[model samples]
Target: MLQVGPDLVCIELKGVNAYLWTGPGGPTLIDTGMPGSWSQLVGDLAAHGVKPGDLKRIIVTHADFDHIGCLKALKAQSPALVACHTVEAVYVRGEKSKPANPSVLGYVVHPLMAGFQRRYDLGVWQLDELVVEGHVFPEGFTALHTPGHSPGHMSLLHKQAGILITGDALSNHKGKLSLPMVLATPNMGMAVESIRKLGGLTYETACFGHGPPIVGGASQAIAAFAQTL
Candidate 1:
């Protein structure tokens, strides 16, 4: 786990990542890592002296299997309320599959993943809140409705902490900032648009789902990347 900002910790779960923020409101978890990642999630929380039942909230960035994988188990173990964008709630509740990509890859890849997607649906989970755009939490994160990776994907910004959690709205995979994988994103154009939206935000440190945190001048780096797009 890496100290992100103030009380925030970036917990690396195998390949994916989750975050733990211990604040005045108690513990808040952002994302839950890949399915069956419960053990690792638990270990990370324990490192911070937190338990599953101690979590105050679980903010979901999107409904992909990897991101919400341990959500079901974690929620069951804790009283933590689950919050996600309204559009993403459908998929989180096992109501609908992630929309297909608008690219040629989606034409082939989505079809093949149909069976796996259904089998992997970690849903039918209950949502305690809807965190739409401009919504602010006591923990200080403002929800940014930056859709692209998924229709309801939302990155979070803790203005007070100067930290931005880019939940696959874009990636810093291999320490390089870039748009989310094209095949995984339904609309590449919309994804680019989302990056532009993030560029408008002010943040000093940026953390991602797949890479190390960019600790300084993160927003400037993002703005530079946005210009490239």
Candidate 2:
């Protein structure tokens, strides 16, 4: 676990990351890591003197397998309100399975990948606490609709803390800020557009779902990366 903001702790589970928001109106979670990552998430919460049931809410950036892996289990242990983009609620409810990435490789690779989740039977969930662009969360964040990776992919801007929780709209993998994996993203075009959207924002720190946080000059870093797109 790593402290990325005044009230945010980054919890890395394998290659993906989840965030714990400890600010006012919080004890909220940003994302949950892959399936079977419940123990890891529990450990991080414990370090902060929090338990699974202590969370006030669980906010999902999107409905990816890696991101929503432990959401159902966590909710079973805690009555935390599960929040996600209104557009993605169907996928979360298992009413609709996510579509394959609109790429040649994706057509072949995505189906093969579904097998992994099938083995674990990650259940579906739905919630009415939906989000939209500019929606202010009670935990003090302004929503940003950043699509392409997934239709309802969202990011959160914590203006007070000067931080942004970038949920795969951008990745700083290995210290290089760039777009998500080509195979993982459904629409490269919209992803680029989302990067441009992030560039226009003001934030000093940026946390990612797939990489370590950029502590300072985060907005500048994202802005610079967006120009190259």
Candidate 3:
């Protein structure tokens, strides 16, 4: 676990990133890493003096397995309320087969990728809340509905801290900001447009779902990346 800011902590599990923020009531979790990562996640939280049941809320950016793999397990352990976009609530509730349609390449590769296809029985748990653009939560975080990677993908912004928890709307691999892989993103065009929207936001730090955090000048970096689209 890495503390990227005063109250922001990042837990990276096998390249997937989840975040912890010291909110007004308790620590708020951004995403739950891949399956089998529950122990590590709990341990990291403990390291920061946050024990089980101390987590007050869990905000899932999307319905991707990699992003919400540990949701059921985590929520079972803690009474944290789970919030996700309304569009993704169906998939989270197991009412839909998929969160979004996959691209041509994704269709060919998804079946072969066991990790992506793994089932976690998350359907048994119902989402406690549905978030949308402009929705505010504890710690002054606001949900930004930036879809394309997934129809309900969201990027969170802590306006006061200038921090953006970019779910899968944007990726920062090796400090490089770019769109997520096209194969996994069924609507690449919409994803690009989302990036443009993010570029307009004012933020200094960026926390990605798949890479290390960008600590400074994050808005400028995203703006520069948007120009290439």
**Candidate closest to the true structure, highest lDDT:** 1
- Output the lDDT of residue 91, model 3: 65
Models 1 onward score TM values of 0.96, 0.96, 0.93
In the predicted model 2, the residue pairs found to clash are none
- Consecutive 10-residue window with the lowest summed lDDT within model 3: 110-119
Runs of candidate 3 exceeding 4 Å displacement: 99-103, 110-118
lDDT, model 2 = 0.86
Prediction RMSDs, each to the true structure: 1.2, 1.3, 1.9
For each candidate in the order shown, give its overall lDDT on alpha carbons: 0.87, 0.86, 0.83
Q: Candidate 2 on 1-229: residue-level lDDT in tens? A: 9988678999998889999999898899988889989888998899998898999988999878788888889888997898888887876765655667887889988876666556556655647488889999899989899998888899999998999999999898899997987887888899999999999999999999898999999999999999998
Residue-wise C-alpha lDDT for candidate 3, range 92-188, written one tens digit per residue: 6666645333656677765544235445665535688898899998668899999898888889999998999989998988868878877677688
Q: In model 1, how large is the Cα lDDT of residue 183?
A: 73
Global Cα lDDT for candidate 3: 0.83
Q: Residue-wise lDDT of candidate 1 within 27-146, one digit each (tens)? A: 999999988788989998999999999999999999887788898888889999899988888978877778788777786787665556567668846799987899998788889998
Candidate 2 Cα misplacement greater than 4 A, ranges: none
